[model samples]
Target: MSNRKIKTFAPKGTRDFLPVQMFTRNKIINLIKKIFEKYGYEPLETPSIERLDVLTGKYGEEGDQLIFKILKRGTGLDKVGVELKEFTVTDYKDIIDLGLKYDLTVPLCRVIAMHKDKITFPFKRYQIQPVWRADKPQKGRYREFYQCDVDVAGSSSMLADFEIIYMVYEILKTLGFKNFLIRINNRKILNAILEHCKIEQNKSFFVLSAIDKLDKIGKKGVINELKKKNINEKVIDNLLEIILLEGTFEQKLNELGHIFKENKIGNEGIEELKEIFYYLSKTDIDSDFYSLDLSLSRGLEYYTGPIYESVVKEPKIGSLTGGGRYDKLIGMFLGEDVPATGTSLGIERIIDVMTELNMIPETKTITKVLITTFDENLKQESINTTWKIRNSGINAELFFEPLRLNKQLSYANKKGIPFVCIIGPDEKKQNKVKVKNMKTGEEKLIENNKIVEFIKSITD
Candidate 1:
C-alpha cells in the first residue's frame, strides 16, 4: 500500500467557498445584480484568459508586471515539467502568449469593439465575474477575486458618469453601508496640476502614481517617493500644495476653478464636475455620501475624464469600489473612440467587511425538513413524503439508511434541519406521520396528505 501524502491546498490567494459562505455570497451578488438590472444595465461575461497583448499596456507599468501570464503551448510546453523552473522573461515572447484578465473593464472594451456593428448605441452592460492578478495576498486582497462591474459605452454625456456614481451609492446603501464616501476627481484636473507644477510630460504618470498613494503612505511618504523618481523639489512642493488643498466639495472646486481659470483642459474638467454635481443635487442622494477631492488620481492610464472611488470608514479595508471615464480605451480596439464610464464593486472586500461586522444573516442550511425512514418497511413512505414536500416547493431531504430512530433524528439535528418526519408503524397504520420540530422539541401528528401544508404554514 502506498502512503504518500497528496497536496490538498488551493493555490495562494484563492479560496474554496463552502455552502454557508456561498449562501452569503449569493445573497450579496443577487442584491447587486437587482440594482444593476434596475438601472437598465444588461449582464455580460468574458473569458478568463485573454491574448497577452490585449491585457498588457492597458493597466499602467506596475499593473503590467502583475498579470499572470500563461506560457505558450506546443513544443515549448514539452519541457514544462523538466525545465520550466529555469525559464526567464527573455524567453517570454516565444513562450508566453496569453494571460488571465486583470480586470473587467478591458474585456468589456474588447467586446464593444468586436461587436460594435451589431450592438445598439449608448450600450449599457453589467458583468459579475472573477478576475486574476499576481498580487500578494493579504487580509482584504487576493490573487483571484470577483468584481461586479457596470459600464455604459457610446455615451459622452456626464449623465452616464453620474449614473455610475449614483449606482455605487445605491448598492452600498442597500447593503447597509452608512459610513462610506464616494471620492471624485478628474484626470484633466490632475493634468492641470502637473502642468502648473511645470512637470515634464514623461514624468506626469510617475507623479500621479505617487499622489494616488497618498491615502496609503500619507503626505510625507508621497513626497519621499517623488524624490526617488528624481522629480524636482520645487515641482513636488508645488504638486503637494495643489492636491493637499482641502475644503467642502464646493469650496475645493471653487478654489481649483480659480487656480485653473486660464487653463483650457482644467476648466473643462471643472465644468464637467459641476454638471455632475448639479445632477446629484436634484437627486435623493445625500450630500454627505459623495465629495470632490483633487488627490484621487486613479492609477489606471486609461481613465480620461472624471474618476471615482468609494471607501468605508468602519472597517478601513480601503476602497470598496472605483471606476472612471475611459473615452479612449475602446478606441484602441476600434478605429475611433467610444465614450465610457463605470465602477466595479469589490465583492470580496465587501463580503469581508460585512462578515467582520456580523452583517450577514445566519443561514446554516438550505434544507427545511428531513424525512427519516422509520424502518425497512417504511422506507418507501419516507421517500414518497420527501417527493411531496419537494413538489410543493419546499426543500426536503430523505434519510438514505433505515437506521435507528435516535440515529436518524441526530442526523437531522446536526444538519440544522428544522423539521423531521417519522412514519412509524403506528402512524403508518393511522395514515399519519409524527412531525417533530427540532428547535422547540414539539411533536404533532400530521395527516399524510397535510404534511406539505403543515410544513409550509410553519416555515413560510
Candidate 2:
C-alpha cells in the first residue's frame, strides 16, 4: 500500500450539512424570506463570482487580504512570461480579475450600476446567499457562510432607516429570538468626534477596531490595550467621556448639539439620529431591543454614516448581525452618491446561539409510520398498505430487512419513526393490521382499509 494518508475529511473551515441539518437551515431561511417579502422587499440574486476589482478595497484593509483568489487557467500563461510554478498568482485582480465574492453588498452595488436603467428608485432588495472568506475559522465563524441581507438604496430618509430597524426587530421576534439587542452608532458622529479630538487617521482605525471589542474583551481590557497602543491617558479619557455621554434620545442629541456646536458634520449626524428616533417613536415596538451604543464600529470601510449591530442578551455568543449606512459605495461605480442602508444576519451564528440556549424547537420526525413485513409471503400486501398510507399524506416506508417483527419495530424506534404498522400472515388473513405508537408503546388492531386514516390520526 502507498504511504499517503487517507483523504476522508472536508477541508478545514467548511462543513457538510446533512439532511436533517439542511431541513432546519432551510426552514430558517424560508421564515426570513417570508418576513422580508412582507416588508415589501423584492428578492434578487447575484453571481457567486465577480471581478476582483469590484470587491477589493471595499471591505477595509484587513478584509482585503482575506479574499480567496482564483488562478489563471491554461498553459499559455508561460508564454506571457508568467512563471506558473515558481510564482503563483494570489491577488485575484492581478491574475484573472475575477474572484469569489466575499459579500453581497459589493455585487449588489455592481448590479445597480450596470442595470440602473432597468430598475426603479428607492429600490428595496433582499439577497440570501453564501459568501466566501479565507479566514481562520472558529466557533460560530466559518470560511463559507451564508448572509441574509436586506437593503434599501436611492433614499436617504431617516424613515427608511427606522423602517429597517423595525424590520429587524419584527423578523427576530417572528423567529422566536428574544434575547438580542440592536446597537446603533453613527460613523459620521464617530468621525466628527475623532476629528475634533485630533486623533491621527492611522490611529483612528486601530482605536475603532479595539473599541469594537469592548463586548468581547470588556472595558478594562480595551483600556489596557489602548494603553499598549501608546494612546495617552488623556486621549483615552476624553474618548470614553464622549462614548459614555448619555441621556434620553432627544436630550442626548441636544447635549451632542452643544459638544458639536462648532462642527457642522457632527451636528448633521446628531440631527439624522434625532429623525430616526422620532420615526421610531411612532411605532409600537419593544424599546429594550434598541440602544444607542457609541462603541459600535461596524469596521467596513464603506460605512460613512450610521451603523448597527445585533447581540444576544446572554452575552455568550457575539454579535449575530451587523450592517450600516454607506453614502459613497454606489458612487464608486455609478459616479454619483447613492445613500443606502442594509444589514446582514449571520445565519450560522444565530443558529449557534439558538442551539446553545435550547431555543430551536425539537425537530418533529416527519416519517410518521413504518410498515414492516414479518414474512416474505405477506411482503406484497405490506407494500400495498405502505403505498396506500403514503397516498393519503401519511409518510410510510416499508421495512427493508427481512427480520423478526420485534426487530423491525426496534429498527423503527431507532430511526425515530413514531408509528409502525405490521402485517403478517395472521393479520393479513384477518384483513387487518396492527398499528403501534412507537413513542407511547401502545398498540391497537385496525381493519386493513382503515390503516390510512389510523396513521393520519396518530400523525395529526
Candidate 3:
C-alpha cells in the first residue's frame, strides 16, 4: 500500500472565494471602479512581479520585514550576501531578481518615473489589484489581498492633496459608510516631533511604527513598546505628549506651529497642512469627515509629506484606507524628485467590515428567468421561448432535463433564479407561457407574442 498522506487545503492567510464571496468582492470592486472613473482617474495596470530593489528600503524596517521576498531557485549560491528580510533571500544579483509586488503604489511610482517623458504631467491613475505580505494573518488582515489605489503625480500643490482627501471621503460615502473619519498628518510634522523628542535618526521609522500602533495599543502601551526598543523615558514621555496634543484641526496645527516655529522643516510641514485646510474650506465637505491627527504616522517611510489613515466608527477594523505624498520615492528611479500623492483602500478589510456590519449587498441573479418544459413534447417550445427572451436582452435559462414539475421548480429555487417561465402542453396549445415569480409565488400567463415584454416589465 502507498504510504503518503495527500493533503487538500489552501495555504494559511489565503482564501478561496466561492461564488457568494466572489459576488460580494466583485460588487465592492465594481463600486470602487465606478467611483474612481467618475473622478476622471484613468486606469493603469502593472506586472505583478517587480525587481527586488524596486520594493526594498521603501516601506521602512518593519514594513520591509513584512515583504514576501522571492527566493533564489538554484540549489547553491557562491558567496551570496544572506540579508534577512521578512523571508530570507540570498543577496545575489542574478539569483533573486524578481519578487511579487508588495503594493500597487510602489510599482505605479516606478511606472511614472520610467515613462515620465511619454506621460503627461499631473497624471492621475487608478489600480485595483492584489498584493502579497509575509505577516501573521488575523481578522481584517491577510497575506494576499487587494489594494484599490488612485494616485495623482507630478504636482506638489496642496490642491492635489485636497483632491485625494476629498476622493477618500467621497469613496466612503458612496460605499454607504456613514460613520468614518479621515485622519490626516504630515510625515514632516511627525519627523519634527521625533526630532524634538531626540529620537535617533536611524530609529525614526521604529518610533513612527510604534506610534502607529496607538490605536491597537493605548498611549501607555506605546510608551511601553518604545521603552522596549530602548527609547529613553524622556523621549517617550515627550512623544506621548505631542501625540495627545488637542483642540480643533486649526488649533492643533497652530499649536504645532508654535512648538516647531524655530524648526524650519517642521514649520514648513505645519504651513503645508494649514494651506491644505484652507483649500478644503471652500468645499462642502462634512466638518467631521477629516481632522488633523498628530500621532498618525502611517508606518511607511516612503511618505515624505502629508499622510492619511481612515477608520470606521464601529467594528474597530484598523485603518480602512491609507496613502500619502511621496516626493522621494519616484526619485529613487528618476534621480530627481517627483511630487506624488495617492490613497489605497484595503479591499479585504473593507469587505470584512461590511460583512461584520451585514452591509454586503444581496446579489442579483444574472439569469433573470429560468424556462422549464413540462415534458419532452414541450421542450422545443421552451427552447424557442428562451431565445425570444434572450433576443430582447433579458437573461433566461431553459432546463433540458425531462424532470417532474416540482423538481424543476426546486431547481429554480436553489439557483435563486427569481422567475421561472414554464412551458406545458396546455400553455403551448394556447401559444403562451406561464411566468412564476419564485420569490412571490405568483404565476401569470403571458401570450408568447408578449412574453418578452412581460419578462422585461418584471426583470428589467
Candidate 4:
C-alpha cells in the first residue's frame, strides 16, 4: 500500500461539534422542547428529502436559489453528460425533482396537505431538526444548522399568534436571555402601502425583500437596492416615512388608521393585529417584549399575514428567530386554504448569544465518576458499581477499554470526570475500591457498598 494520502475535511459551511459543543447544543434543544411542551404543542417529524417542486417558489426568488438539489441515483451520470452538452439545466425542471429540504416550513406545508383529512384542525406541533442552506458560512451562519420551530395550523385565531409570540419571549428569557425584543409586522399592511403608492404587485416582492435586510444593511443600502428596481425617491421617502414613524402599538395603529382609510384590506390587517395585542395584554407574560416594527418585513412570498423577528437588545448577534403567518400556502398544496403561523428559533445563534452574555451554566453534571475496567475478572464488579451509582441518581459510567491505569485516568480527566473508581484484584479481594478525585488530586479507599455515597459527596 502507498504510504499515505492527505485526509479530507468536512465540506465548507459545515462543522463537527466536539463534546463541549454538543453539550451546549443539546442543552439549548432541551430548553426549547420544555418551553414548547409547556405551551401544549405536540412534536412531529418529517423526511429530510422533499420533492423539489414542493419547495420551489414558496420562498421567493433568492430563497429558491439556496435549495440543495439531489441528483438521480444509479446510471444517471450518462443522462447528465448528454443533457449538459445540449443545454443549461434551467429549462428542465423535472430532471431535478429531489432536494435536501431547505427549511422545515415547506415540507411541513406538504405534510399538512397530505394529512389534512386525517389530522385534526387547529394542530399545534413543534419540530427540532437540521435544515440545509446552500449559503456561504459566516461568523454565526452555517450550511447545516438546527431550527427549533413551533407552529399552529388550521386556525385563523389571532390568539394563536399571541401565544406563539409569548412562547418565544418566555423560552428565551427562561434560557437567561434578559435583553431581547420580539418585533412584529403585518404583510397586508405592507401590501396596502405598496398599492397606495401605485407600485405594481410584481415589483412589491422585490421592494419588501430589499427592506427585509434593513436591519443588517441599513436604510441607505435598502434605498440603493430599491432605486435599482426603478423606484422613485418620492415613493421611497413615503415608504421610509411609514417605516420610521414609531410609538406604542396602539399609537401606531392610530397612525395606520389614516393610511388605511381607502384600503379595506389594510384596515382588516390592522384590526387583526389590534386583536392580537389585546388578547396578549390579558396574558401573564410581559407585553413589553413585543414591539410593533413596521420595517420588520419577513421576506417570504408565502407570508400573507403577521410576521415576527426576535433580536437580542445588546450587541452580540443577529436575529435569533423569525417567522410569519402563511395563510394560503396550504392552498397551493391541498387545493384548500389553511391558516398557519410559526416561528423558527436559530438554535446556534441563541447559544452564541447566551455564551456572550455569560448565561450558559457550566455544570459539572455530566458523567461525574468513571469506574475503570481493570481486568475481565473484575468487569462484573465494575459494571455493578456503575449501575449502583447510576441508580443512586449520580451520573456514572464504566470504562469500556482495559487500557493502562494512567491512560484511563487521563481519559477520565479529559472528559471532566471528577472521580475515577479503581477496582483491581487487590481491591476486589478486600471488598474496597479506590476513589480518585481528579479535580482535587486526592484519592481515598472506600468500602464497595459505600462507593456510591463517596462519589456523591465528591461531586456535590
Per-candidate TM-score against the hidden true structure = 0.95, 0.89, 0.91, 0.90
Q: Over 4 Å off in model 2, which ranges?
A: 1-5, 75-96, 216-234, 313-315, 374-377
Report the lDDT tens digits of candidate 2 across residue range 1-460. Answer: 9999987998878999886777678888999899989989999999888877898999988998888876655535636766666755555445566689899898889989999999898989999999999999888878999998999999998777777888888878878887788888888888888877778998998888888887778878888988989988888988877876777667767877788888988988888888887777777876678878878887789998878888886747677888888879999999988889898888988788877888777664568889998777888888899899989977778997779878998888877889888887778889999988887889899998887887777789
**lDDT agreement of model 1 with the native:** 0.91
Candidate 2 local Cα displacement, residue 195, angstroms: 2.0
List, in order, the clash count of every candidate structure.
0, 0, 0, 0
Clashes of 4: 0
Question: lDDT values of the candidates?
Answer: 0.91, 0.84, 0.86, 0.85
Order by TM-score, highest first: 1, 3, 4, 2
| Model 1 lDDT per residue over 1-460, tens place | 7799897999999999999999899999999999999999999999999999999999988999999999788635756356666645565668789999999999999999999888997999999999999999988999999999999999989999999999999999999987889999999999988888899899888888899888889999999999999988988888898898888767777898888879999988998998898899899998999988787898789999999999988787889999999999999999799999998899999999988888889788989999999778888998899999999999999998998989999998888899999898999999998999999999999998898999899889
The most accurate candidate by lDDT is 1
Candidate 4 regions with alpha-carbon error over 4 angstroms:
78-91, 217-221, 284-288, 313-316, 362-365, 374-380, 390-394, 400-404, 442-444, 453-460
lDDT of 4 at 368: 82
Candidate 4 local lDDT, 371-433, one digit each (tens): 999988888989999899999999888899888899999898877887899999989889999
Q: Candidate 4: give the clashing pairs.
A: none
Ranking by lDDT: 1, 3, 4, 2
